[model samples]
Target: MTLPFPSLEDLVNVISSTVDYIVNIVYNTIRGALIDFYNWLMASIEWLLNYIRANLPFVISVVLTWTALYKSVTAENIPLTRRIMNILTAPLFSMFALSLVDALLPREIKLPRYSYPALAIASVYAETEARAEYIIRHRTGYVVEAEAETEARAIYSLGS
Candidate 1:
């Protein structure tokens, strides 16, 4: 029997090619799994969005009413008269607050509306006009800052 002798360069090339093939397979498998996971997450999000869209009014009503009820219930620490007022007017106030949110704020982003009741409460409880305006602007995502110079135009205008 004649013994087969492989050259060093041939052995090295064979080993290198095998390693490269295994690495490529591993990489492709991992990449494919990641892509599939991403697609599944995106589909789930789209499904949720479609569900919300299908029940827009109901969702809005529930959100507003829930926020108002939560706020009223949490006002136990406040003055009794004010707490009573908030409880009585939470429904109407919630509607107005949510309307402002829908009309003024950007639709792409759903801002936290739980703060609406607190802002409404503060606007009623505030002692100064400046404080009330500040609350209003803050709640509406419109904040005014002190300017350094007259020529210094507002860095960001509204809706920018």
Candidate 2:
């Protein structure tokens, strides 16, 4: 039996296409993963906000205020130069903080009779258990969701 050999131009075209396929895969993988992660984060935040609004307004306010304070502190810990720059941009930071409090705190929680600080404290107890997930979880964070999404896409393409 005679074996058929691949022609020179045919071999080159095959190699080029193969490389293109690999590149496309890698790019699509990363892009898909990021999209997935972003979608996941947005969905989670929306769920949290809606949930807090409907079933846990008071608790949501407290948790949100805590989240604001925590984020501000973290932002404050930047290197001296960046810290100075951020301080210079103080209004920007304050705006961001206020926005968090505004967005996360349900209006019902703002009734005239309510005590903001007290509610936050009460929320602290309620949200304390999940604190570590955001405060203490490993560095992967939302990035991992993106990565996993990409990996799944690549695997599916290969398997199919």
Candidate 3:
């Protein structure tokens, strides 16, 4: 007599087909997301490259300005003369380099004439403020203590 239930072979085939369908769906979904991500990444890179190429002079100017700001601000523990020189020369050199780059590269955008100088001035102001705050916080207490000790010694000597 024939069995009422499906045969083992038929059951195995159904399960195998179900697993294959699920795997294909998952694989296609992951593959599509990866392709989209790759396309987006490539497009971003291409846009960045084109922007840099088109605005090479402005880019150079910005880089030079930031370099000058960094050099001037980081010159903290140096001698007065050296610090002055650093503060002065960094911006000058940056401006000169920017000018050179502007001349050398074909520009689609022009950097403002006053931008570097303004940024330099702002950096100097920031450095000065930092130094002032440091002195106020770190040196004021020592100065007050030294003066008090000197006065106390003088008073003792006079009493003796």
Candidate 4:
């Protein structure tokens, strides 16, 4: 005789269909989220690549200008007037340099592959500043050179 509930076969079929419906819903949700994330990441990279391609010439000009300004200002053989011009106009180049460094540089002290030119420019600026300070304070280049030599010797010395 049949019990109060439906037949066992019908009961089994209903349970199976419910489980399949739940699994499909969950799977579709997860897949849609992953697909959307992948699409967003690809779009962002594509936009960046396009932006760099369009602005490459301007970026190169800025880098070259900053490099020339730095080298000219640091060179001792260059005439004082030209050096001064280079130094004064340095801030213009520096605006670009500063922006690039701030936007591109990581927050760590370690240098990345793109930081070589920035490092060189910074080194030149530091050297120029130090020499200027020494000249202003001592009124002589010889004294500064001598002091640098002494500092180097002290640093390299092994004695007590």
Instruction: Please tell me which predicted candidate would have the highest lDDT against the true structure.
Output: 3
TM-score-best of 1 and 2: 1
Instruction: Please provide, for model 4 over 40-95, each residue's C-alpha lDDT reduced to its tens digit, 9 standing for 90 to 100.
Output: 66656656766665565456657767787879977989999988888678667766
Better of 2 and 3 by TM-score: 3
Task: Put down candidate 3 lDDT per residue, 1-160, tens digits, no spaces.
Answer: 9899999999999999999999998997786566556656665665676587667766676687777767666867777787677767766776787678767765443221100000011123545552111111111122111123334333332322
Minimal lDDT window, size 10, model 2: 112-121
Could you give candidate 2's per-residue lDDT for residues 16-47 as a string of tens digits? 99999999999977866775576566656666
Which candidate order results from sorting by lDDT in descending order?
A: 3, 1, 4, 2
Estimate the TM-score of every prediction. 0.38, 0.31, 0.38, 0.44
TM-score of 2: 0.31
Indicate the residue-level lDDT of 108 in model 2.
40
Q: Stretches of candidate 1 above 4 Å error?
A: 1-3, 61-160
- Summing lDDT over every window of 10 consecutive residues in candidate 4, give the lowest-scoring window: 111-120
Q: RMSD in Å for candidate 3, one decimal?
A: 29.0
CA-only RMSD, every prediction: 22.1, 23.2, 29.0, 26.5
Tens digits of per-residue lDDT for model 1 on 44-118? 675676566555645575687777778767866788788777767867766776566556543442221111111
